[model samples]
Target: MTETTIPKRGVPLWVQIIIWVFIAALLVLVGITLNKRQQGTVQPGDKIPDFTLPLFSGYEYEGKSEVKLSDFQGKVVVLNFWASWCKPCEQEAAELEEAWQFYKPGGQVIFLGADYVDTEPEARAYLKKFGITFANGPDMGTKISQMFRIRGVPETYFIDQTGELYYVKVGPFVSVNEIKSIVDQKLK
Candidate 1:
Protein backbone atom coordinates (compact mmCIF):
# COMPACT_ATOMS: atom_id res chain seq x y z
CA MET A 1 0.00 0.00 0.00
CA THR A 2 1.30 3.55 -0.96
CA GLU A 3 0.99 6.26 1.71
CA THR A 4 -0.69 9.47 0.41
CA THR A 5 0.47 12.90 1.69
CA ILE A 6 -2.33 15.40 2.77
CA PRO A 7 -2.05 19.19 2.15
CA LYS A 8 -2.90 21.49 5.13
CA ARG A 9 -5.62 24.06 4.45
CA GLY A 10 -4.96 27.69 5.48
CA VAL A 11 -5.90 31.24 4.50
CA PRO A 12 -4.28 32.48 1.32
CA LEU A 13 -1.51 35.05 1.55
CA TRP A 14 -3.56 37.62 -0.46
CA VAL A 15 -6.53 37.22 1.89
CA GLN A 16 -4.32 37.75 4.95
CA ILE A 17 -2.94 40.98 3.50
CA ILE A 18 -6.44 42.24 2.72
CA ILE A 19 -7.59 41.45 6.26
CA TRP A 20 -4.68 43.36 7.76
CA VAL A 21 -5.36 46.36 5.56
CA PHE A 22 -9.02 46.37 6.59
CA ILE A 23 -8.04 46.23 10.26
CA ALA A 24 -5.66 49.13 9.84
CA ALA A 25 -8.34 51.22 8.13
CA LEU A 26 -10.84 50.41 10.86
CA LEU A 27 -8.37 51.39 13.57
CA VAL A 28 -7.68 54.72 11.87
CA LEU A 29 -11.39 55.49 11.56
CA VAL A 30 -12.00 54.72 15.21
CA GLY A 31 -9.05 56.83 16.27
CA ILE A 32 -10.30 59.82 14.28
CA THR A 33 -13.79 59.49 15.72
CA LEU A 34 -12.49 59.34 19.27
CA ASN A 35 -10.19 62.32 18.76
CA LYS A 36 -13.04 64.46 17.44
CA ARG A 37 -15.30 63.45 20.31
CA GLN A 38 -12.69 64.36 22.90
CA GLN A 39 -12.34 67.95 21.63
CA GLY A 40 -15.41 70.05 22.42
CA THR A 41 -16.56 73.47 23.53
CA VAL A 42 -17.24 74.00 27.20
CA GLN A 43 -20.93 73.89 28.05
CA PRO A 44 -22.99 75.64 30.67
CA GLY A 45 -22.48 74.58 34.30
CA ASP A 46 -18.87 73.65 33.65
CA LYS A 47 -16.09 75.48 35.43
CA ILE A 48 -14.10 77.71 33.08
CA PRO A 49 -10.54 76.50 32.86
CA ASP A 50 -7.86 78.82 34.21
CA PHE A 51 -5.27 80.28 31.85
CA THR A 52 -2.65 83.06 31.66
CA LEU A 53 -1.53 85.05 28.63
CA PRO A 54 0.53 88.17 28.06
CA LEU A 55 -1.47 91.36 27.67
CA PHE A 56 -1.44 92.31 24.02
CA SER A 57 -3.22 95.66 24.34
CA GLY A 58 -4.80 96.48 27.65
CA TYR A 59 -4.31 97.69 31.17
CA GLU A 60 -1.67 95.77 33.06
CA TYR A 61 -3.00 93.27 35.59
CA GLU A 62 -1.85 94.57 39.01
CA GLY A 63 1.78 95.47 38.20
CA LYS A 64 2.45 92.40 36.06
CA SER A 65 1.78 92.46 32.32
CA GLU A 66 0.23 88.97 32.02
CA VAL A 67 -3.47 88.43 32.46
CA LYS A 68 -4.71 85.44 34.42
CA LEU A 69 -8.25 84.17 34.13
CA SER A 70 -8.37 83.37 37.82
CA ASP A 71 -7.76 87.03 38.65
CA PHE A 72 -11.26 87.87 37.46
CA GLN A 73 -12.92 85.28 39.67
CA GLY A 74 -16.05 86.44 41.56
CA LYS A 75 -16.98 88.68 38.66
CA VAL A 76 -19.01 88.09 35.53
CA VAL A 77 -16.51 87.35 32.76
CA VAL A 78 -17.31 87.74 29.08
CA LEU A 79 -14.43 85.81 27.59
CA ASN A 80 -14.11 86.19 23.83
CA PHE A 81 -11.81 84.22 21.55
CA TRP A 82 -11.08 86.02 18.32
CA ALA A 83 -8.52 86.34 15.54
CA SER A 84 -7.69 89.41 13.53
CA TRP A 85 -7.96 87.56 10.25
CA CYS A 86 -11.55 86.46 10.93
CA LYS A 87 -14.25 88.66 9.41
CA PRO A 88 -16.84 87.77 11.98
CA CYS A 89 -14.43 88.84 14.66
CA GLU A 90 -14.11 92.13 12.88
CA GLN A 91 -17.87 92.48 12.67
CA GLU A 92 -18.39 91.83 16.34
CA ALA A 93 -15.46 93.94 17.48
CA ALA A 94 -17.43 97.12 17.80
CA GLU A 95 -20.19 95.48 19.74
CA LEU A 96 -17.72 93.96 22.15
CA GLU A 97 -16.11 97.35 22.67
CA GLU A 98 -19.50 98.88 23.26
CA ALA A 99 -20.41 96.25 25.79
CA TRP A 100 -17.08 96.74 27.50
CA GLN A 101 -17.60 100.45 27.86
CA PHE A 102 -21.15 99.92 29.04
CA TYR A 103 -20.32 97.66 31.96
CA LYS A 104 -16.87 99.00 32.70
CA PRO A 105 -18.07 101.74 35.02
CA GLY A 106 -20.14 99.31 37.08
CA GLY A 107 -17.01 97.23 37.73
CA GLN A 108 -19.04 94.04 38.01
CA VAL A 109 -18.39 92.58 34.57
CA ILE A 110 -14.98 91.93 33.03
CA PHE A 111 -14.56 91.69 29.28
CA LEU A 112 -11.47 89.71 28.40
CA GLY A 113 -10.52 89.17 24.78
CA ALA A 114 -8.20 86.30 23.87
CA ASP A 115 -6.56 87.26 20.59
CA TYR A 116 -6.37 83.80 19.04
CA VAL A 117 -3.78 82.81 16.47
CA ASP A 118 -2.62 86.25 15.45
CA THR A 119 0.49 88.41 15.26
CA GLU A 120 1.01 91.39 17.51
CA PRO A 121 0.91 94.02 14.76
CA GLU A 122 -2.27 92.78 13.09
CA ALA A 123 -3.93 92.10 16.41
CA ARG A 124 -3.11 95.60 17.50
CA ALA A 125 -4.39 97.00 14.20
CA TYR A 126 -7.65 95.09 14.53
CA LEU A 127 -8.17 96.35 18.05
CA LYS A 128 -7.23 99.84 17.04
CA LYS A 129 -9.56 99.77 14.05
CA PHE A 130 -12.49 98.75 16.22
CA GLY A 131 -11.35 101.05 19.03
CA ILE A 132 -11.50 98.16 21.46
CA THR A 133 -10.54 99.50 24.87
CA PHE A 134 -11.22 96.32 26.78
CA ALA A 135 -8.50 94.05 28.07
CA ASN A 136 -7.14 92.18 25.04
CA GLY A 137 -4.38 89.59 25.07
CA PRO A 138 -2.70 87.21 22.67
CA ASP A 139 -3.54 83.53 23.06
CA MET A 140 0.20 82.72 22.69
CA GLY A 141 0.57 79.25 21.15
CA THR A 142 -3.22 78.86 21.27
CA LYS A 143 -3.10 77.46 24.77
CA ILE A 144 -6.27 79.22 25.84
CA SER A 145 -8.01 78.32 22.60
CA GLN A 146 -7.22 74.67 23.17
CA MET A 147 -8.37 74.92 26.77
CA PHE A 148 -11.68 76.41 25.58
CA ARG A 149 -11.86 73.93 22.69
CA ILE A 150 -12.51 76.84 20.39
CA ARG A 151 -14.03 75.64 17.16
CA GLY A 152 -13.63 78.95 15.39
CA VAL A 153 -12.93 82.59 15.80
CA PRO A 154 -15.28 85.07 17.52
CA GLU A 155 -16.43 82.47 20.02
CA THR A 156 -17.47 83.81 23.41
CA TYR A 157 -17.85 82.18 26.79
CA PHE A 158 -19.80 83.66 29.64
CA ILE A 159 -18.75 82.97 33.20
CA ASP A 160 -20.93 83.83 36.12
CA GLN A 161 -19.81 85.32 39.42
CA THR A 162 -19.02 81.89 40.85
CA GLY A 163 -16.43 81.11 38.10
CA GLU A 164 -18.73 78.63 36.37
CA LEU A 165 -19.47 78.77 32.68
CA TYR A 166 -23.05 79.92 32.21
CA TYR A 167 -23.41 80.46 28.45
CA VAL A 168 -21.51 80.08 25.19
CA LYS A 169 -21.75 81.85 21.85
CA VAL A 170 -20.04 80.00 19.05
CA GLY A 171 -20.04 82.91 16.59
CA PRO A 172 -19.83 86.66 16.56
CA PHE A 173 -22.35 88.24 18.86
CA VAL A 174 -25.32 89.85 17.08
CA SER A 175 -25.27 93.16 18.88
CA VAL A 176 -24.27 95.00 22.00
CA ASN A 177 -27.72 94.39 23.46
CA GLU A 178 -27.24 90.67 23.03
CA ILE A 179 -24.06 90.82 25.06
CA LYS A 180 -25.65 93.11 27.59
CA SER A 181 -28.59 90.76 27.96
CA ILE A 182 -26.41 87.82 28.87
CA VAL A 183 -24.11 89.86 31.08
CA ASP A 184 -26.99 91.51 32.87
CA GLN A 185 -28.71 88.24 33.53
CA LYS A 186 -25.51 86.73 34.84
CA LEU A 187 -24.81 89.81 36.95
CA LYS A 188 -28.12 89.29 38.67
Candidate 2:
Protein backbone atom coordinates (compact mmCIF):
# COMPACT_ATOMS: atom_id res chain seq x y z
CA MET A 1 0.00 0.00 0.00
CA THR A 2 1.38 3.35 -1.02
CA GLU A 3 0.83 6.13 1.58
CA THR A 4 0.12 9.65 0.22
CA THR A 5 1.74 12.65 2.07
CA ILE A 6 -1.07 14.64 3.59
CA PRO A 7 -0.61 18.39 4.16
CA LYS A 8 -1.18 19.66 7.70
CA ARG A 9 -4.00 22.28 7.81
CA GLY A 10 -4.57 23.20 11.46
CA VAL A 11 -3.57 26.86 11.30
CA PRO A 12 -6.26 29.30 10.08
CA LEU A 13 -5.69 31.59 7.10
CA TRP A 14 -6.19 34.67 9.31
CA VAL A 15 -3.38 33.52 11.61
CA GLN A 16 -1.02 33.16 8.70
CA ILE A 17 -1.90 36.63 7.44
CA ILE A 18 -1.37 38.18 10.86
CA ILE A 19 2.07 36.62 11.16
CA TRP A 20 3.02 37.81 7.73
CA VAL A 21 1.77 41.32 8.50
CA PHE A 22 3.86 41.55 11.64
CA ILE A 23 6.94 40.39 9.81
CA ALA A 24 6.36 42.87 7.05
CA ALA A 25 5.97 45.71 9.53
CA LEU A 26 9.20 44.79 11.25
CA LEU A 27 11.08 44.71 7.98
CA VAL A 28 9.70 48.12 6.99
CA LEU A 29 10.82 49.70 10.23
CA VAL A 30 14.29 48.24 9.80
CA GLY A 31 14.46 49.65 6.30
CA ILE A 32 13.37 53.10 7.48
CA THR A 33 16.07 53.15 10.16
CA LEU A 34 18.73 52.31 7.64
CA ASN A 35 17.54 54.87 5.11
CA LYS A 36 16.43 57.78 7.28
CA ARG A 37 18.33 59.45 10.15
CA GLN A 38 20.38 56.88 11.98
CA GLN A 39 19.52 56.01 15.58
CA GLY A 40 22.92 56.79 17.04
CA THR A 41 23.35 59.90 19.17
CA VAL A 42 23.87 62.85 16.87
CA GLN A 43 27.05 64.83 17.43
CA PRO A 44 28.99 67.51 15.60
CA GLY A 45 30.63 64.95 13.42
CA ASP A 46 27.34 63.59 12.05
CA LYS A 47 26.09 65.04 8.81
CA ILE A 48 22.36 65.74 8.54
CA PRO A 49 20.61 64.40 5.47
CA ASP A 50 19.28 67.08 3.18
CA PHE A 51 15.55 67.72 3.70
CA THR A 52 13.00 70.17 2.31
CA LEU A 53 9.94 71.61 4.02
CA PRO A 54 7.71 74.65 3.67
CA LEU A 55 8.49 77.42 6.18
CA PHE A 56 6.23 80.36 6.97
CA SER A 57 8.88 82.99 7.58
CA GLY A 58 7.37 86.40 7.80
CA TYR A 59 6.36 87.93 4.47
CA GLU A 60 9.43 90.15 4.62
CA TYR A 61 12.24 88.28 6.45
CA GLU A 62 15.03 88.11 3.95
CA GLY A 63 15.00 84.59 2.52
CA LYS A 64 11.66 84.11 4.26
CA SER A 65 9.20 84.01 1.40
CA GLU A 66 9.84 80.27 1.05
CA VAL A 67 12.72 78.54 2.80
CA LYS A 68 14.30 75.11 2.85
CA LEU A 69 17.35 73.64 4.57
CA SER A 70 18.92 72.93 1.18
CA ASP A 71 18.85 76.61 0.19
CA PHE A 72 21.28 77.59 2.97
CA GLN A 73 23.96 75.20 1.81
CA GLY A 74 27.58 76.42 2.18
CA LYS A 75 26.74 78.76 5.09
CA VAL A 76 26.41 78.66 8.86
CA VAL A 77 22.76 78.11 9.80
CA VAL A 78 21.38 78.81 13.25
CA LEU A 79 18.26 76.66 13.32
CA ASN A 80 16.00 77.33 16.29
CA PHE A 81 12.92 75.19 16.92
CA TRP A 82 10.37 77.27 18.76
CA ALA A 83 6.62 77.65 19.49
CA SER A 84 4.20 80.44 20.27
CA TRP A 85 3.37 79.12 23.74
CA CYS A 86 6.91 78.82 25.09
CA LYS A 87 7.77 81.74 27.37
CA PRO A 88 11.49 81.21 27.02
CA CYS A 89 11.10 81.30 23.26
CA GLU A 90 9.27 84.59 23.58
CA GLN A 91 12.17 85.93 25.61
CA GLU A 92 14.71 84.71 23.08
CA ALA A 93 12.89 86.19 20.10
CA ALA A 94 14.31 89.65 20.50
CA GLU A 95 17.82 88.40 20.71
CA LEU A 96 17.17 86.24 17.67
CA GLU A 97 16.18 89.40 15.86
CA GLU A 98 19.35 91.13 16.90
CA ALA A 99 21.47 88.23 15.78
CA TRP A 100 19.62 87.82 12.52
CA GLN A 101 20.00 91.48 11.60
CA PHE A 102 23.64 91.47 12.49
CA TYR A 103 24.47 88.23 10.73
CA LYS A 104 22.19 88.28 7.69
CA PRO A 105 23.80 91.09 5.74
CA GLY A 106 27.11 90.62 3.92
CA GLY A 107 26.04 86.98 3.40
CA GLN A 108 28.20 85.45 6.08
CA VAL A 109 25.63 83.47 8.14
CA ILE A 110 21.97 82.44 7.96
CA PHE A 111 19.35 82.15 10.70
CA LEU A 112 16.33 79.85 10.44
CA GLY A 113 13.46 79.10 12.82
CA ALA A 114 10.86 76.31 12.62
CA ASP A 115 7.60 76.79 14.53
CA TYR A 116 7.03 73.47 16.24
CA VAL A 117 3.23 73.02 16.66
CA ASP A 118 1.11 76.14 16.54
CA THR A 119 -1.95 77.61 14.92
CA GLU A 120 -1.45 79.62 11.79
CA PRO A 121 -3.12 82.75 13.20
CA GLU A 122 -0.99 82.72 16.33
CA ALA A 123 2.11 82.05 14.25
CA ARG A 124 1.40 85.05 12.11
CA ALA A 125 1.07 87.23 15.19
CA TYR A 126 4.30 85.84 16.66
CA LEU A 127 6.08 86.77 13.49
CA LYS A 128 5.04 90.42 13.84
CA LYS A 129 5.76 90.64 17.57
CA PHE A 130 9.04 88.76 17.70
CA GLY A 131 10.64 90.73 14.90
CA ILE A 132 11.90 87.44 13.46
CA THR A 133 13.12 88.53 10.07
CA PHE A 134 15.14 85.49 9.16
CA ALA A 135 13.79 82.25 7.77
CA ASN A 136 10.89 81.38 10.12
CA GLY A 137 7.87 79.07 9.70
CA PRO A 138 5.67 76.32 11.16
CA ASP A 139 6.29 72.59 10.83
CA MET A 140 2.52 71.83 10.62
CA GLY A 141 2.77 68.31 12.02
CA THR A 142 4.05 66.90 8.75
CA LYS A 143 6.67 64.62 10.31
CA ILE A 144 9.10 67.47 10.87
CA SER A 145 8.84 67.30 14.65
CA GLN A 146 9.46 63.57 14.57
CA MET A 147 12.39 64.07 12.21
CA PHE A 148 13.96 66.39 14.75
CA ARG A 149 13.09 64.10 17.69
CA ILE A 150 11.76 67.04 19.63
CA ARG A 151 11.27 66.36 23.31
CA GLY A 152 10.31 69.88 24.23
CA VAL A 153 10.01 73.38 22.91
CA PRO A 154 13.08 75.52 22.12
CA GLU A 155 15.59 73.00 20.87
CA THR A 156 18.17 74.73 18.71
CA TYR A 157 20.60 72.96 16.43
CA PHE A 158 23.43 74.71 14.67
CA ILE A 159 24.53 73.40 11.30
CA ASP A 160 27.90 74.25 9.84
CA GLN A 161 28.71 75.07 6.23
CA THR A 162 29.14 71.42 5.42
CA GLY A 163 25.59 70.59 6.64
CA GLU A 164 26.82 68.95 9.81
CA LEU A 165 25.15 69.54 13.13
CA TYR A 166 27.69 71.73 14.95
CA TYR A 167 25.89 72.40 18.26
CA VAL A 168 22.64 71.53 19.93
CA LYS A 169 21.09 73.78 22.59
CA VAL A 170 18.79 71.70 24.79
CA GLY A 171 16.73 74.39 26.49
CA PRO A 172 15.63 77.87 25.72
CA PHE A 173 18.63 79.69 24.29
CA VAL A 174 19.26 82.83 26.29
CA SER A 175 21.72 85.70 25.97
CA VAL A 176 21.55 85.97 22.21
CA ASN A 177 24.58 88.25 22.41
CA GLU A 178 26.58 85.39 23.89
CA ILE A 179 25.82 83.35 20.79
CA LYS A 180 27.59 85.90 18.65
CA SER A 181 30.95 84.39 19.52
CA ILE A 182 29.73 80.88 18.86
CA VAL A 183 28.10 81.87 15.60
CA ASP A 184 31.07 83.86 14.39
CA GLN A 185 33.44 81.01 14.97
CA LYS A 186 31.28 78.38 13.27
CA LEU A 187 29.76 80.58 10.60
CA LYS A 188 33.03 82.11 9.51
Provide the TM-score for each candidate, comma-separated. Answer: 0.79, 0.75
Model 1: how large is the Cα RMSD against the reference? 4.6
Residue-wise C-alpha lDDT for candidate 2, range 12-125, written one tens digit per residue: 999999999999999999999886655533566678776655667344345446666777788888877888888878877888789888876668688777888788788778
Best by TM-score: 1
Per-residue alpha-carbon lDDT of candidate 1 for residues 44-98, written as tens digits (9 for 90 to 100):
9998777887886354444568877788878999989988899988889999999
Flag regions of model 2 displaced more than 4 Å.
1-41, 60-64
**Candidate no. 2 TM-score:** 0.75
Clash counts per candidate, in order, are: 0, 2
Q: What C-alpha lDDT values do all the predictions have?
A: 0.85, 0.75
Residue 33 displacement in candidate 2 (angstroms): 8.1
The reply for model 1, stretches above 4 Å from the true place, is 1-39, 57-59
Q: What is the lDDT of residue 20 in candidate 2?
A: 99
